[model samples]
Target chain A: MTGAEGKPAPGKEGAAVSGETETAATEVVAGAGAGAEADARVGVEAGAGAGGQAVAGAGAATGVRDRTAADTGAPDELWARLKAYEGRAATVACAGKDPVNAPMIRHWCEAMGDTNPAYEGPDAVAPPTMLQAWTMGGLSGHEGRTDAYDDLLTLLDEAGCTSVVATDCEQEYLRALRPGDEVVFDAVIESVSERKTTRLGTGYFVTTRMDVRVGADLAGTHRFRILKYAPAARRKPRPGRPRPVVNRDNTGFWEGVARHRLLIQRCTGCGTLRHPWLPGCNECGGLDWDTVEASGEGTVHSYVVMHHPPFPAFDPPYAVGLIELTEGVRMVSNVVGVPYDKVRIGLPVRLEFRRYEGAGTGEDPLVLPVFRATEGGA
Target chain B: MAVTADRPVTAAGAELPPLEIPITRTLIVSGAIASRDYQDVHHDAELARRKGSPDIFMNILTTNGLVGRYITDHFGPRAVLRRVAIRLGAPNYPGDTMVLRGTVEQVDGDTATVRVVGANAIGRHVTGTVTVTVPAGGA
Candidate 1:
């Protein structure tokens, strides 16, 4: 969360009573000149640390807290009343004649997982992928809020529903964010549905969409699925790492080998067989390599039945293993066709073709690699 | 509010010149949407408050977008992202305001590395490194 503090800090006493419901109708407008200015180059001492003190100063400026305490019957009505003014958008916008520069863009470059020089040098430009960060407005300025899915809880509570839990998250990326660009953001309530109610009071699934724009250009959109469930119901954990999605790039590799067949990569230079196609060959600096058929014979190199899914799309207590092909190539494959506990390391396994659901449908489906124990092999 | 710029090219132990970028709530939200992250913290303040977050936390994806733009804006349109590594430190809170600063640390061939930082109306919030490939000549 973006605050003076790295983590969620305690909210003011008044914020509790004011309640987000009351503040829901209020809209905050901010810009380059939103708040009291700070020395631009003070670094951390002034920005994150001084921000807390500035809030205190705002509280002291108007001795209204004392006045509100005497007039209102509420314990912290004055404090709550003060919260409206005390709270500001949690983000700090960057604006100037030279908004994008070495330092400015570098920070974002690091954030997006793109540190490629081809994108950030003076003559080089940023890739489209970097746009993901530029469009992000900032963190909610409110303190003590950090969970990614906590908003659903608050909305459910406001709706007289206390049982709410985040079920899953699915995300996709479009454009890349760069420095100096000004962005506009708005969260649109998409759809709220009461799925079903069981022993738990009510099972509701609320989905919200957010729209992003850059100077009137529709940048992208996001959808969130918030699931509200009863507190006592034992919620089944979501699948870990959804089955791997195979695209044109890796489809051939799976179909040929998984169907009791073998496919291998042969170097153009030496005509030696290679399992995986890398950028260059060890023998020759050539990037040339061809996909060829392989023999479906190999020994088990290493195996692991993961009880946990790394990507949240697959259930745990499953198995994954590395197999050494007769061609001296090693491949990572998911181990299946046997009980989880029955699978052992160094057991021989063979290629098996299995169907897996993908992000798309029909003409374009995701494919995965599956392996099974050889009849007499392991 | 006082607005001043010395036009200093570098700071103490800094590698490159300082840089700035105009930030916006729209930019943050759009970045989040583009990344397919619709967490209320980035969009709805009420939702953020209802949850435990003091406010919305800028998703790492959005931060990367803005930072990428910041560098490209300075380097021009031809630059490519070579390697970028960032450790998210402070959250860039909405309305907090930021002024990005950094120093060029190294220059090799068509690539250059920078140590960067983003500060708000209050102070510095993010710090990290960025390396980009420039044209044949240095920027």
Candidate 2:
């Protein structure tokens, strides 16, 4: 979703357009150092808002829309034209930074804290999910990307799909990637979904399919999807607290909250226990499950101090703990009864069911499980 | 979109099961980003506060998605959501829980009308009516 707006403000890169599809992007980017922008910071100002007004502010900043409307019939038409690139190979990213190697594999495994012995020896195969890792172009930027890619972004940007995020990625490994295998790949713009509205806002779903090869052998295909859209309006807060989102998978867990009990899901198939209840057992694939009441005793496996977003419902820099219960399952909840800075990993703690009144916003008393330090010193 | 007379309609006063989902930073950021919303108010706490919000708030898109999920889940995959009218009432900031519950309001032919309320500790986050056309067997 990086577009002309991403390049600078339109004030910096104005002389670009779209009557012809191919050189239109090149000529536009070639127009890059326009240099007459005494008021170029308008783009920055517009981005700072990032809400409904921001796009309009950005549009007002450059008046790029008037020209866009005139040139391509409309921005939507420009988006439709991008579908032509579908089913075509993108410019090759690179021969890949290096051949698949054990050192990098070791590093990745270590970073993920994986300890499988099968990964350490000469017989080791890189993790199947590491398929995309071998093909990354990294921070220096991918070498083989063409202007077509940037044009798609600029077109989307001009249409005000300024924000972008990778929604999810799906990868299938056809075979094991071993050491000294030179990895090469080409990606295709497989499909662009029609404008669809979601919980985020309205935008297109762009799926890129990457085919990975090792010495002409098809290794894997990685499919990644990103959503590009204009942010929707924020909801107006009512007097009461916001409600919890519950579905079939986790309804029983909330019922436990209502009853002042912390329940963990136990797999009847394998007698394995887990938290944040799942409908099926991750270990045994068992759909039949039961509940186990938590002993309320655990230790801080890890913790985070949240400070950036301050809400009337919570104090800033509060510590949220990932508590590993005595029953051997971990859940995240607020860490109470200690200074935010003092909460530590492995600190023994006790869980308490507590209610937070969301500042008289008319939200009902909210009940949750939080941890309290039993005895601790850093 | 089709419904069968033999398929039992959800009783008018019956409550759809309540769902309890924990709201976290990952959920808030991913949901917003996935919905193509780059509004800083949904992700950046500091920027949101500067923009006069108490904190980064959930966007309407996520709310809409959840509501859609609420109906589809009840009637199963074969059900088609035709119309959903929702009004937002509260902010679903990170760390809060959102409990969604619904009741059947009316049913005519293949279409059944349902009303849903998504409430958090602070209060109702969303209240709306959803019209879903279920399969003849209530799929």
Candidate 3:
């Protein structure tokens, strides 16, 4: 029976006690510390740790606390209190805002530039990476979130660890989430790491495990981790432009850039040309390929001026264009020598090699290919 | 459209035709909205700058969607996706381009597993493995 204080009655036994009761009982024992051994013994006897137990048996009895005590600023005590929150519910049976449906799927595919036919038509299922998307509360946020996670964060904030960054997340899909399947999930504070020093600062890593479900069957699990840290002095280093990703298939292209040459892949079998490089030609499925130096004369097939989210290496309000080369291949590059607003489709442009000074970060100077609008073409 | 009758014969070392996606502000914002993720960092540039990002970046779901697209685009319409597991690295900002490349790693009966990596100007945006079932038997 739920007692007046919401804690399970001390002597209750058997499967009748709900998960909420077990969680409440575990919290009480963890807060009361070693003095609650008798209660923990009873908890073990009553099948309390089955679904929602925070810490089992002797584990809960060791981290006793004086809830009314003032801050001691001791790292061990803070860590102990943080560890006590492990296995607590972050959100319980939270319902998705929208069920798996087609309209949203279409929108997602469109934005991602994806035209895979499997995502359309009648049998379409939500994208698997959409595991977390379905759980997001959107503008208003869901009401199913519990206070424990927030309380943990507040405790860290009070301890001078205020800044937060999401490090990474991993997901495993058990089944495809189809339209009309009502998504429901429960999240648990899986663990909290001890204080550690990182490049950003000293902080603790908190990871949460969420099990998403449809009806009573488990569908997938998502584990997310974030680092809560104290702020360090801001470094004034000017960040360099993001480096291009180069791998085996396209290393030749980058090598071309280093030599101030723009190279396009040409199929050895069919003579078809391709841009951005590929291992096999799409037209011939030929594995052997050779490179051809581009003439660099092209017209802007399309363009977009980026004004937001400024980067240190380049000025904003510049035009990035899809240049369709005379050789019949298109590639994306910055369009220069013209105002961002003046750049237009079908504008004639010529390629130029631009050298960028490194940010004194021990990186070599980078030479990249950009397109400049022809005189009077703008 | 008749199920193609014949599917491409898949092998372990087969490579998928690469896809190039121009990262644009429209793609970033629409991807966020479509996924129902209303986080400020995904849609609002000023707020994102205040929070330390240079601009709004692509959400993980969008990255996932692109990866899924890369696989199915190669395996054709009848391809059924079973699993997608990915980890994020570099953020995908507008004015950049992300090129997705995939290789068929294993094929067992109708199910084939592919390794996918999406790289942009900054670095590798996403790396993961996807398992899908493609229709059996073709050239």
Best-fitting candidate, scored by DockQ: 3
Fraction of native Cα-Cα interface contacts (under 8 Å, chains A and B) also present in model 2: 0.00
Q: List the residue pairs that clash in candidate 3.
A: A33-A64, A309-B55
Docking class of 1: incorrect
Please give, for residues A260-311, the per-residue lDDT of candidate 3 as tens digits: 8999999999999998899999998999999999998999999898998888
Q: What is candidate 1's lDDT per residue for A1-378, written digit by digit as tens?
A: 112211111331111110111112111111111111221110110001100001112221110111111222324222232222222322212111232335545544443434456455555433544332333323332232223224434544444344332221122233444455554443333333323332222323333333334555544433323323222222334433354455655565666645645677677888777655565577777677777775556666887878654555566787677878777888887767676666676677776666654433233334455678774433
Candidate 2 chain B worst ten-residue window by lDDT:
B1-10
Best by lDDT: 3
Fnat of each candidate? 0.07, 0.00, 0.28
Go through the candidates in order and give each one's C-alpha lDDT: 0.43, 0.56, 0.65
TM-score of each: 0.29, 0.37, 0.55
- CA shift of A14, model 3, Å: 30
User: What clash count does candidate 2 reach?
Assistant: 32
- lDDT of model 1 at residue A97? 23
For candidate 2, write residues A1-378 as lDDT tens digits.
111111211222111111001121211111010011111001111111112211111221110111111122234454467565455444453466768888876765543333444345877766544555665544343555546656666666666565443333444456668888887776655655545433333444455556677866877765544544443444444334345798999999999998988999999999999877788889989899999999999999999999988665565889988999999999988888888999999999998988766535555688888899988535
Candidate 3 per-residue C-alpha lDDT over B17-119 given as tens digits, one digit per residue, 9 for 90 to 100: 7889898999878987876655566677776565455677776566767787777667676676777766555667789898888888998989888888777
lDDT of 2 at B55: 59
Per-residue error (Å), model 1, residue A364: 71
Those runs of model 1 whose alpha carbons end farther than 4 Å from true positions after fitting are: A1-128, A131-378, B1-17, B121-123, B137-139
